[model samples]
Target: MKLSKRLQQVAELVPEGAVLADIGSDHAYLPVYLVEQGRIRQAVAGELNQGPYESAQRTVREAGLSHLIEVRKGDGLAVLGAGEASAVAICGMGGGTIVDILSAGRDKLAGVQCLILQPMTDSDRLRKWLHDNGWRIAAEELVVDEGILYEIVQAEPGDERYKDSLWYEIGSVDLLKHHPLFPQKVSAAIKKIGRVLQNLRKSQGGLAAQKREALLQKKKRLEEVLKSCKQR
Candidate 1:
């Protein structure tokens, strides 16, 4: 099974010998790859939709990994209990949905040592949720696969700490520094901010001005961060 660069990057972050549960495991590719590579001892592919759930089961069986990977049809983390998995991977979903899943299953995460998440959108929301819920960003990576940029964040529950201000807008500076696509990511964000500011300037409303100013400030801060990354 050939995995996308983004999925492969997410799989690489899973520590060797860990037990993994992949939430929304569409096709169950990640778990199957990890088990075949001996990177994880065991894995469970959790899916809600019938199509993907059955597809995951078929993939596991085809890969000859049915003994090592379990395909369970369920929503979010409800399929597994605490202590069942050392790490959890939730990918190909929005950040808000990811946060909601984790939030809903907070009790089941007590034994989870690591979380690898790739949000399709609302990444800042996911980061804020992690910080608010006592999860510390251990590492972050950016990968562009077929012209789409994806951010993979590895977090663990703890008081590792992050500023509330930076939590939503920017990811971990350390991880950003090491990102293979850091320049492109920052450049793309700058373009987005610029476009937003331009639109805000054209709109006439009481709230528009305030929103524009706030976005402008954020744009400046992002520029500064990008400059710092360049210096490194």
Candidate 2:
């Protein structure tokens, strides 16, 4: 019933006694661990393909949580009924894909109290999607398992806009500043923006100049955030 650092952070976001639905639940480790820890009362593990579906079933069965955790073969939140899950966890997927899943299953989220998402990339787009769809980023977590950094976004039903468009690209500085990896996260983002700017400098396209200017502004904002944190 052990969970990986990434999944463990997602698990931590689930409120106690919640009925959680885990999307793309490969191996079903998160649900098993949550149930074992008495963190949740029940869970539904959803897998899109047969291989992972069977793997999840086996994991739940082996853990003897068959009575508590149901393994379903389906795509995204299709395995869930409206109001069936109070919390949903989607981990280890690209942000765009996670956003699409949530978009397509909007009906199934009628009563979902929280969404715990771990996006492998496009964190900016994911944040934008949440803001547009009335989900407020309640809390954020940063954890690096092995050498890879992962971000876990815990959101609840609400609507809130960032200070400007840039906050979506880099999450709320106030929320992220508390994490031990805050500096690393900001530096990594700055590095990424720098690489893009360097590529833009070589581009002959009409929009390259405009894009570079915007990214440069973003990078400056990130540095300012880092410096402000240090001054505190």
Candidate 3:
């Protein structure tokens, strides 16, 4: 089955020979594809809603991967049991939602070596949570598909901190790997923060002032990144 560029990037991050659990697995395509390629021996496709749950089941059955992939219906990591998977892939969800899921089902993460996260929004919050909780980012990927940019972060259990605050505020520069869209990503971030600063400037509240200050700092960091990219 064909996967979107975003999902394909997520799939490529999964470690070979590791069992995987694809959370919010819309059609279980990632797990099925991995299994077909012999990248993983087993997988569990978890979906929260019934419609997608049934659809996942159908997909796995149609792919004739019923023995290698199990489609289960439950919210977040609740569908998984301890030691059931070595890696967890939670994609196409908001960063705040992903944080809640990880926090809620943290106990199930025992023995899990890796986490592949693709947050649709507020990824900084998710990264902060991971850093504070001891999940060091092992690798990261950024891909733009159909004019929409997406980030895929692969983290494993460890303790690590960024030398520059921009690593967290913006993202890991080392992980960007000089992607062709690096400039575009930096430009887009600068524009997004510029809009935030504009809106915050019009507001007259203590929180707004603080937010504006933070955004200004972030904007500068992004600009520096953009400049450095141009220099290279």
Candidate 4:
């Protein structure tokens, strides 16, 4: 089973011999591939919707991994139990939704050692939540598939401290340093902040001054990062 570049990167981060759970497993390709490769001892593919859930089951059966991989129809981490999986992979979802799923299933994560996350959007929120909570990002990577750049984060439960400003803006600075797509991502962010600043300046309102100031500050910070990236 061939996985996308993003999914392949996420799978590579999974520790060998792990009991893995793939949350929101759309096609169950990742788990099936992992099991077949002998990377994991057991795997579970969790899906909430009927169409995807049935598809995942079919894929697992077709791959002849039904015994090693269990397809469970459920939402988020609700299908998992403590110690059932040592590592969890939640991918191809919005960061806020991923954070909500992890936040809601904190108990199930007690015995888990690693969380491999790939957020589609709002990655800053997910990073903030991880930092505020106990999870600390151990590694991060960037993968470009079909002209889209995806960020993959590997975190473990602990007091992992991150610089607040960098964490809020770029998800993880350590990851950003080695990011394959950092130039593109940071350039896009700089353009976005510039656009927001322009709009704030053009608008005339009672709070325009304050809003403009905030936007300017954000723009400056982004500019600094952009400049640093260029320097390197």
TM-scores of the candidates are: 0.95, 0.96, 0.93, 0.94
Measured by lDDT, the strongest candidate is 2
Which residue pairs does candidate 3 place in steric collision? none
Q: Which residue runs of candidate 4 sit more than 4 Å off their true CA positions?
A: none
Task: Return the top candidate by TM-score.
Answer: 2
Summing lDDT over every window of 10 consecutive residues in candidate 1, give the lowest-scoring window. 161-170
**Worst lDDT 10-window in candidate 4:** 171-180
lDDT order of candidates, top first: 2, 3, 1, 4
TM-score of 2: 0.96
Candidate 1 local lDDT, 62-174, one digit each (tens): 99989899999988999998889999999999998998999999888988999999999999899888887889888898888898988999998788656547546567776
**Native-to-model Cα distance after best TM-score fit, residue 102 in candidate 3, in Å:** 0.7
Cα error, candidate 3, residue 107 (Å):
0.9
What is the C-alpha lDDT profile of model 2 across 1-232, one tens digit per residue?
7778878888888999999999999999999999999999999999999999999999999899999999999889999999999999999999999999999999999999999999999999999999999899999999999999899999999979897776787688768877788888888989999988887877876688789888888899889988876766
* Comparing 1 and 4 on TM-score, the stronger one: 1
- For candidate 2, give the lDDT: 0.91
lDDT of 4 by residue, 1-232 (tens): 8888888999999999999999999999999989989999999899999999999999999998898999999989999988799999999999999999999988888779999999999988888888888888888888889999888888898897665675665766556765657878877887887877777777897698888787777767767776777778
Task: State the TM-score for model 3.
Answer: 0.93
